[model samples]
Target: DSFKSAAGSQTAKVQQVVTSPDGEKRYWFKLEGGQASPGMGDSPEPVDATITQDYETAAAMSKNELSGTAAYMSGKLRVSGDLMKLMQLQGALGQMPTALKGIDVDY
Candidate 1:
């Protein structure tokens, strides 16, 4: 609900890179028609924004122990491209906790 509302009519292709001792993992997702669909590896097409961060920072952000805005400001996270578009997806990203609640992560 919130995601859809916040997403509005926005459309974008976003890529994310998380680096850790295990190396780097990349993910791409598309926000279109008020829905977000994620995929592994690189994006099939060009992206509007790319966010890169360490695994710890990403984990912290996922657990709500840290905020994305703070991470970016503190140099823990890096983002490029249409930042405003990415920020607009903040509300959508906020739903991650609930959406990921049932999933079991190794770290």
Candidate 2:
């Protein structure tokens, strides 16, 4: 994920917790020396930062319709733990559209 690219030479674990009808769901990825790897389950393997937001907010943020920084400032997004990690990802959030370009989905 671009978040990992934004991590540069740092090592960080960024987790996202989204509210689900049953309760909550979690997704996360880790970055080490600029490489990204996905993680599974509700908790991060070694959480450096966590983002607590609903699916809608996440989607909006991902699509570039909403800014993570603005969302964080407006309470639409919440972050905990090492806020610095989240800060690094802030710019990557804006690149989602660019990243989505030239994609051909067979399905």
Candidate 3:
């Protein structure tokens, strides 16, 4: 998986929760295998880390109008669990065009 490949041995399950005006959405990534998808529910494996953001903030991240690191620093992004795992994947995460590339944002 792209995430696993990117992090190499740094394996973890990352959950992304988005709260938007329309509704809420969730996604997960198993960094070891780089597996990511939508929907929120129980997982057989444990979640090592989680990132929470509202739709607009996430969209800002995608367009590089804002940054996850900066957002996190400013408390716009909420993080829980294994912060190290997120940090380890920082390089990979930073390359993202948008936090949710599939979703459209006005920018």
Best by lDDT: 1
TM-score attained by model 2: 0.73
Question: In candidate 3, which residue pairs clash?
Answer: 62-98
Error of 2 at 107 (Å): 15
TM-score, cand. 3: 0.70
- Cα lDDT, model 3, residue 88: 78
What are the lDDT scores of the predictions, listed in order?
0.85, 0.70, 0.72
- Listed per candidate, the RMSD to the true structure in angstroms reads 1.6, 3.8, 3.7
Q: Mind giving the per-residue lDDT tens digits that candidate 2 earns over 51-80?
A: 899777877776668888888899988888
lDDT of 1 by residue, 1-107 (tens): 66677677878899999999899999988988878888999999999999999999988987878888899999999998889987887877776555556677777
Residue 9, candidate 3: C-alpha displacement in angstroms: 3.1
A best-first ranking of the candidates according to their TM-score comes to 1, 2, 3
Which of the two, 2 or 3, has more lDDT? Answer: 3
Clashing pairs in 1: none
Off by over 4 Å in 2: 1-5, 96-107
TM-score of each: 0.86, 0.73, 0.70
